[model samples]
Target: MDKINLLVTISIIIIFIALFLSLFLLTVKTAHKLSNRLFAFFLVLTAIDISANLGDLLAISLNMRIFISSFFFLQLPTFYLYVLSVCYSDFKLKRKHLIHGVTFLIANLVLLPRFYAVDEDSKISFLANIKSMPEIQFNHVLMHIQMLFYLVAAFMILRKARKIYLENYAGASIESLNWLFQFTVALSAFYFIALVKNIFKFTEYPNISAGLKIGLVLFELIIIFWYLYKALNNPGLFRTIDSKLKLVQDIILEEKNSNQFTINEKEHSEELLKLQHYMMEEKPFLSSSLTIQDISVAIEIPVRDLSLLINHTLEQHFYDFVNAYRIESAMDILKDSTKSKLTILEILYDVGFNSKSSFNTAFKKHTGYTPTYYRKML
Candidate 1:
């Protein structure tokens, strides 16, 4: 067709492909299957909603076009549920949650008789009339109202979840799914703008609605592709929230971020001793992903002060300080007669070193000999 229609058609095709890829990767590759499955369901609802628009653009038959309005009300609930799945560790799509989609179901049921009554020739007329019906008009208004409510609710959940996560384990390498937050914000803005424009018919231009639809299609395509790229690269992006850790981390982050604490030199040395005692007792270095931030949180010292003590007082960088403990731990494992059956790789992993090369390098740096050589000598 024309350039505008061509762009819409291309965007539709790209979105379809992107949706398939996203669903496939999210279902197969992700760690937390439940959350990813929920996300995939959201994408499916989005695809159905967009497909209805594409059907209108293609002048698809009345049978296909008549039901397009029925799918419109499901988008917000699906999105909100998806957000719930990601942010809550124990979220389950219970029967009660299906109440959110009750309006969609009722709307579709009410239209079913009309859908069958309209023939192919009169389908467009039927669709036009359906839109004008008092009930349908009410539903249309209600859809936007529902959208506004759910948008706010979903954002509140996400913001709270993210805040909790950062407070507890700012140093953890867990995927935060911040993209979903951005997506929801963008979607809310797009829908709000569309609602306002439609209500006011703000444009004098005859074709502005078509242009807006095309622009929305383009924006959705961008979001879909970005989602696909991230899903493929980071399969664990939708993993379940660590609620317990988040709670604890929030407490720690609050304490750390607070400005009320101070330390004199004597207290600094005392805190340093406490750090040493905790390190020796807890051996948090056994976690490969441990960070100075994690340590600082655990020790209840400011990260800056902890870094100063490790780097200046102990004459070691944070990484070196942690690795020094890991290497030492590995040596103990190697030297222990009862642990003689453990493999070098196993020993390395046990002490929190993720790779053999790093373990070997650290071991050699500390002991002036390779692990295997040291073990053999022992």
Candidate 2:
């Protein structure tokens, strides 16, 4: 097929896949209903945005084109909201979120006077002179600025959420968090390339612009397929953190500044000993879904104190702290001659690691060898 036909065919497939994913997200029976809905909406917006690629082939009218293009304003904001929803379990669709659509409203207002309110002949004339229109220029600039802002904000949220996950949850949760982080990074890279493509569009090099556009479509196609593979392989990929949870560092800083919380050296040592005893004797780390709050309750320590003890005094994240014990337990099993028949998978699950990949990673990090290599040496 010709280049235009190939591009159009790819765009059509992307739209179909995007819509299919959106429908699946909307209807999927998941704990993160709100997050799924937000993401579904974002996907729908994406499909609409991609539909613009078909304008010429479909003989799309100017008004219809304008309507479809207007959704561009909502796309990134919806994505931003989806990021927020994924990060925070308590996230809800608040009335204040409507403010995100202000740019869309403004874009429509800008078009009203020049294009939308005019007749077909006038609209075509306006389109011919669109490059010189200040309104079009302003909207283009605004769109780019909004994309930059939302992409940055989404990244910051993901970074903070990952840190919080490390400080509060166990190692098993890392895979899901890493998946989300990868998704955000991929989207960010896509947006950056799209920005570059937009810049090239105004340059004299039409061929370069077209090449970038094709590359973007191909990049997007890969992302969707990768997402599908991940989603199908790991049905429980999404995990949420309580929005009210504070970072351990933030808690420590606040306590130090306000002098509202203090622990003497003796008390700190006592708590550390207590935590260690419980971890050793009770083996609380055996629970794959363990959290710092669970440890606090089991050891009769305050959550804040537990956070401070493991995250601050021990100089280790709660995740690493728990995983350390689990790794130790797995090591003991590996060393035992009586348990020679126990497979690495069996040992991993017995020691609270739900995923073999996480177990292998933690074991290798702790022992400088993969579980298989470590076992073979013995």
Candidate 3:
């Protein structure tokens, strides 16, 4: 019995030491301010949590009560703040958000007396709460309620996070963010489940001591360090090109090399000019998913220069460039008496538009009329 106790004490201390180091390292790392602040809050919670466990191990009932009270009380506030921090884009913290914490505090305070442990007759021995008969029920109905609060906060974070980074390359970054952010949510979920399980086996598994609870807290600490390390490594997210100057440098270098290569391939470049002949004679732009880059590649022209030429000569963005071809093809289709029998949607699909909505949107934007209206007027 004494041997088991000693090992538990030593194992817990080691975990707390790592927890402190992770927090210290996180403090020094550069990050988005809201995430840093929220993570710091979690670090503080870990410290309190460590104290709660250590207090119980020491059998210092007074210290243990203080630690639990403080941890649980502050947790109500940190819960929503952590969510706000994770999902925060504008970094605006409002007074209204405090209501979530305040509401929890008031509810907890009202039920505070029931939290103290009952005398020996009661079965809830591990946690000395208001479980004593006649005074208050031992069952922690409030804890279950708190679990609901946690779920709501975590779910909100998950819901809001989906929209932040929507660019083609941002999917991986979002995945990484979800993995890290989900740690807190996952911990809360485990704690809740273990708690429910504890209630069911309250008599038999007193020895188990909520392994999942301890594990979740430990996991939260470890997750902080892992996230902090990744944050430091990725000053800018992977492949997202965090530096504007780097993008400009790439564009200039690419254009310079394109000009040099074209000069070297003068005869071949002259043959490449056959693209104009093909577009006029073959009308290949009628194909679906054909963008300016596809055309530039086919004609052996530098995409950047082709874009430059289009912008200087035609004053249009790439989106508009593609749509112009689609719209012209739609016009050509409309002119044929046999194809006139085809529906506007069919014509749009035949012209390579992947969706009716997209076809209508692009056609209207380019030709100042919806496909149906354009066909009607023509």
lDDT of each: 0.70, 0.87, 0.54
Order of all candidates by TM-score, from best down to worst? 2, 1, 3
Relative to the true structure, candidate 1 reaches a TM of: 0.62
Write one digit per residue (lDDT tens) for candidate 1, span 1-378.
585577658667865775886569465844567766776776776777777656545666665554665676787887788787777777777889979988787776665655546566565566566546665666667777888889999988887776544443322223444667887878887787677546544346536666666676777777777777876765545544554433433443565689634436897689889988988999998986676678888888986567556655665656667777888888889889999999999998888876676678778999999999999998
TM-score of candidate 2 relative to the true fold? 0.96
- Point out the higher-scoring one by TM-score: 2 or 3: 2
lDDT of 2 by residue, 184-295 (tens): 8898899889888878777777678788888888898898888878877888767778878889889988988998877689999888898888999999899998988898
Which segments of candidate 1 are over 4 A away from where they belong? 1-4, 56-64, 109-126, 129-131, 171-177, 200-206, 242-276, 279-378
lDDT of 3 at 170: 12
Instruction: Highest TM-score: give the candidate number.
Output: 2
Give lDDT tens digits, candidate 3, residues 35-141: 55665665566565555545445565542454354465455456556655555445456787666565445544544453333343332442454323332232245
Give each model's clash number.
3, 0, 8
Most lDDT-accurate candidate: 2
Residue 102 in candidate 1, Cα distance off native in Å: 1.6
Instruction: Give candidate 2 misplaced runs (Cα > 4 Å).
Output: none
What TM-score, over all chains together, does every model reach? 0.62, 0.96, 0.49
